[model samples]
Target: MTGLGWVGQVLTVEITGFAHGGLGVARHDGRVVFVRGALPDERVTARVVDDRKAAFCHAELVEVLTPSVHRIDPVCPAAAAGAGCCDLSFVTGSHGRELKSRALADQLRRIGGVDWEGVVEPIGSSDTDAPQVGWRTRVRLAVDADGRLGYHRHGSDEVIAQTDCAQPVAGLTDGLAGLGGLRPGTELVVSIDDAVGDAAPARQIVQIAAPSRGRGRQRRRPRTGPPRVIEGGPTTLRRVGERMWQVPVTGFWQAHRDAALVYSDVVTGWASTGAEVAVGWDLYGGVGVLAGALRDAGVAQVWTAEGDATATAVAVNSFADDSGVHPVTGSTETVVTGLPRPGVVVADPPRSGAGRAVVAAICAAGPDTVIHVGCDPAALARDLRLFAEHGYRVRDIRGFDAFPLTHHVEAIAVLNRDR
Candidate 1:
């Protein structure tokens, strides 16, 4: 059938495998169908949502004819109603992590030609019984026309107002009640300082962004003004081990409470190996978390590069006491060429992953060690292949189930240059 003919049509198919973006893989009539809300080894009936491509189409699960043993009742009502927050909430936490591991391994082997047989390790919490939920320290919510705060539907701009999402930390969503009067289409960036113990009380920070202004049907201009702070202070505290950082409420920070510490430790361990590392480069270094790790690991000089000026200012102020840590504000692709050559380079690029130009630049710099972090498995795999073209061999790779109850996973790969 043609692409347009498949739209709105329902078909039953057996899911043979999982895809990177939490979709189930199935074949029907010589075309691949990506079905949401379905799991591998299960038979599901799904409605075709988009069939723009002739080779494959997108679908939404309608009915599960054969549910997997790992499937369970969704923990959050919003998720059950198709809110985009907890895409994998229907599966057990262990099973979800297992699926993520398999997905990551598949990406590495297929796209990067690197064999990986590791599992995605879970980040634990004090709430042992409900560890998967209430772990998100940061959340971005959309305000609908009715002034309700919620998340957008999957692959859509329509907002689904939600008062109870399972992914946020405790009390992070408490401000949702008082947020009804905000302008329609405005965005809310909510953050919390989830430090444990009596010394540091949990504090919530809320920032509001104005609705994007544009002519009808034209592309909306980016929000130029900074988000106005509504609740709490302008900055919130986040700590990794003994070090503390005052991250701006509107600035970038790890969403999971324990993600900073976990990733920092991982980067430290990986960057510490190999020959004497005098100088290190931290690309896309937000607030200098991993750069601090490099410094702590005895790198004499560390240059942390971030594009956001506000984030770079925070990093500079946070590291003012130590001159060895230099925070520069510029695109990594541009700033990397002017900086002094380093023995090791650590890059934590955005979800799009570091492109070929950036990867080629890093390779041209001739760093002895390269530590790459990626949130998207497919993008990471592609970049790994690019690095391989530049003579970097993968040494160790680890996956972290940082965003629990969701399909998102964080992965870090350590690579060493071939001598």
Candidate 2:
């Protein structure tokens, strides 16, 4: 397939294709161009939008001359608007999940090289089923010159704004489109979803910051840190639960919506069930969100340890509203050392995975089972091998496509210590 570049050819052609990020491959400029809004077996008038040195150009579908058998008209308002979500333009709901499964399997093989020992199964949770309905209860939007609230353009500094979206949570459509009084030139951070409902089981939490702060920009600092609004500024939202959050922006929380339930379900299920006394040591625990979930599921005693003072404060408040979870605040490693040995140990470290000392510490703690939930597969694999060397053999492994449409997958491994 090398050197087959057709830069200017627009000939009628039919070919099989795949749906990856709203893109399907076609010969453009004598090379492959991943086209938007194009389906398999569809003839289209396309134009090259991006060209890579590797002969892969990004194409835009101008017209569909012939559509594919699998082609289905997307109902999402943002699908073809070309400015909202990055992919899933022509995908059916079921097909979207399947594509997610396939992508996860392929990534494990190609990236982590972990085999059949790996269980690629659908995680049962409130979030796994989120993609179907308007599960996105929150969003941050930018205001265009026309006072429209939408997302920013892909690479440009401009915001191509819109008033409504199809995938927003139930009341978010009205919330976003109804931001009534704003200074003419002022930008806004709009909040939506179920924050108003404290008793709704299906509640959601959504936030859209105004003056639309640029991505990669620091969540605007409080002159004295959040809990304190700046003299003239935006609301800061720090999420504590699905629909519960304290707005003060600089607060840290997991970025994805589907992450909490998936992480909680995997960790809770892996903690040996129906046991009277299963003690869990949650290392690198962020505000004890995971530990609280396990506690709700019947773990006898959960000793959650974390490093952040502010997050620990939030954790304390979170558990104070509940019961059974004890928050231990300190460095993740130092906190692990002071805890009593337990039957189960779960660690969800940041992107670098568990460090060398942390891995050794997990081994030192010597639980009957070590459940490692990590964001990076390579780093996770490294620690998994370390645990194997120290007698924590990986018996069952599972992965969750927490970050949909991206290369990120959350893999949790259950290791059984030698009896």
Best candidate (score: lDDT): 1
Q: For residues 179-223, could you state the per-residue lDDT of candidate 2 as single tens digits?
A: 544333334433332343474323222233333344433535224
Question: What shift in Å separates residue 273 of candidate 1 from its native position after superposition?
Answer: 2.6
Q: Each candidate's lDDT (Cα)? A: 0.86, 0.59
- Once superposed on the true structure, which residue ranges of model 2 sit more than 4 Å away at CA? 1-68, 116-131, 145-147, 180-263, 273-279, 296-300, 305-308, 321-324, 328-342, 349-364, 372-394, 397-413, 417-419
How far in Å is the alpha carbon of 299 misplaced in model 1?
0.7
TM-score of 1: 0.93
Q: Any runs in candidate 1 off by more than 4 Å, and if so which?
A: 1-4, 125-131, 200-202, 210-226
Worst 10 residues of 2 by lDDT: 224-233
* Candidate 2 lDDT (Cα, 0 to 1): 0.59
How does model 1 fare in lDDT?
Answer: 0.86
